[model samples]
Target chain A: MSDPAAVPPLLDARNIACQRGGRMIFAGVTLTIGAGQSLLVRGPNGAGKSSLLRVLGGLIPCLHGTIDRHAPIALADEHLALDPDNRLEQALAFWARMDGVDRERLDFALHHFRLRELADIPVRMLSTGQRKRAILARTMASGARLWLLDEPGNGLDAASLRGLGDAMAAHLAAGGGIIAASHFDLSHQFGTVVELDRR
Target chain B: MTRWFLPLVRRDLRLAWQGGGLWMPVVFLLLVASLYPFAVGPDARLLAATGGGMLWIAALLAALLPVERLIAPDRDSGIFDQLLMRGISDEMIALVKLIAHWLGFGPPLMLALLPAAALLKLDGAAIMRLELGLLIGTPALAALGVLTASLVAGLRGAGALAGLLILPLAVPILIFGAGSLHPGSGAALKFLSAISLLLVAITPIAAGAALRAGRE
Candidate 1:
């Protein structure tokens, strides 16, 4: 890992607070994740883990906070965000094109996630676990510097879960950062852990 | 913007075609135009005098057929959020959607007008004028459709609300487009294009704001 003092943090959020439907969800939250580091967020049901990830991804605004994002981010949430009518390869390629990554990177992402065999199938035809794998493959293919994953382990089988762990390890080793909100044990070490509880 | 613009437009156009319901608007426009002559007992002179305006009304209503599908599906499926994350502005998305929506429905409606004109007993001159009026007016109607769609995207029963929001705002386009069908009404066509231009220009900003407001 690189020296923390030498490089600026990839994400620097301070005094963050969020609310939904006129009620405070979480507040006074602060965290930082630098290159080659990770942050794992955990909370019970309705505890705002997903909301925090959304806020961090810039999908929703924080009620009170300052977020300084120094690099591009890829987000994987419950919504697959892929075109259902498109083949898995085409769906992922759309994002790859939008992200300006070359075809080689997309091929590597597909191979990394073991999605090569399922590339020709329509996205809607994938099973629950395969769908989760596809979503992860999209994140990997984005070539983003930071990844924000929400409940990424929901439907993955043991092997797929292991693949996810390996992918996360590779991402961090290559100077990418991660902030994941998950209930299942991801089997990866996180440099910082944040626990959010409902008030 | 250039990097993703063409790809987004192409993706949307492919989906619009692949979705397979584009024929609904074209069929609906023809149905309404065909039914008009039946409702008014066939009188060639009467048909010629009023057929062009009736077609304009049918075209306006035809534009509404595709409104519900314009923004709701993409927004619900999180496509908008994903696009926004890619640094594509809400205005650009709205603009692309407007273009895609128009391309999907505009030309087909024009083609269907041919058979509908034959049914209405319209002369060759009136047919040409009506065609020209619709060519300029459909873009504005499409803008209205997309604008209302964005405003009511997340609401329950958005179709009904879309009609309510669009018909009132569409009066200007309708008046100019229909008025242009009258004899020697030279300025009406210019007015029609001006309104169409204004609507097309403002739709992106208005609809973009609505999309942002829906997020909250």
Candidate 2:
């Protein structure tokens, strides 16, 4: 087995700052996560946790920071991101194709999220927790090395929440990393936690 | 990167077709062209003289029909963020969407123009000129539509605002395209082509910037 220390961190961010509409969000934030690890970001509403995730995902520009990403990333924010008109399986498959992942992985992700039976349903018909599961399935199917989740536990049931913990543990065991933002407790304990204060 | 181009275009085309986005504008164009005769009391010479210009105007308005559908839904649904996360640049997304938007409306509008021209009593020569002008001009109209859609994508009342934004930017193309049908206006065709090419070239970059700005 390769020395875990020798593998560079999956994400290396330093002095990261973000702002919106010319207002400062947060500044002087720094964190790093290596393979087989996870980081949890905790904060109240409007504390910029989602914006920070967006910055880390490169979806939005950071006002001041240097970030080095060593692997591909997947994000599951509040946005469902699935095509409303497409069947669940097809919608997930579209992203799988985009990520260069194969059919087997998509099937595995569907089963992983307990969405196999719901695969034929149109995405628009999915209830809130089911939609959240679909988003997580999309992230899982992406085969990316890092996962960025925003409010991942919002609508999950007790059993599904436990399944989420199992999935995170399995991902970490497989050398994938996670950065999730949520005030509620998830199944797995993160290696590190950073709490953001409202500015 | 190149591999994604066709699939994205195909997806967009499918959506446009399924959503009735492809045919609505064609129907709108035909309806407007057919109405011109009733409003003007069909004198053959008058129809022939004004028909080409009326079609150009109708085509411009038709381009506006699907503006609200172009980027707003995808933006609202986080499709843009997902694509961006996959390392697809915003410019590529805009370009693909521009191509798809054109494919959806431009050809159908031209085909619709055939019957519309017949309704307007245009001669064979005039019909050919109108078709040629539209072939050159419709791409610019599509680009303008995509650009405006990107600019106003997340705003309330985006459809009305998109129409307002696209019309003024489209004046040059309209003037040149409509003027090309005038007798001995070969230079007008060249000007139309130039402006069309310019809009197509810049739309992806401009719309891409608009999308990134919208994130903030």
Considering the two chains of model 2, state its CAPRI-style docking category. high
Model 2: residue B19 alpha-carbon error in angstroms: 0.8
What are the DockQ scores of the candidates, in order? 0.68, 0.81
Predicted candidate 1 versus true structure: per-residue lDDT over A83-191, tens digit per residue: 9988999999999999999999999989987899999999999988888888898898888999999988889888888889999999999999999998756888888
Candidate number achieving the greatest DockQ relative to the actual structure: 2
lDDT by residue (B1-216, candidate 1, tens digit) is 788998998887888788764787788878887888889978988987888888898899889987888899999988898888788888999999999889888898899999999888998888888889989999999899989999999999999999998999999998999999877887999999999999999999999999987884
Model 2, chain B only, scores a TM-score of: 0.98
Clashing pairs in 2: none
Q: Which parts of model 2 have CA positions greater than 4 angstroms off?
A: A1-6
Best by lDDT: 2
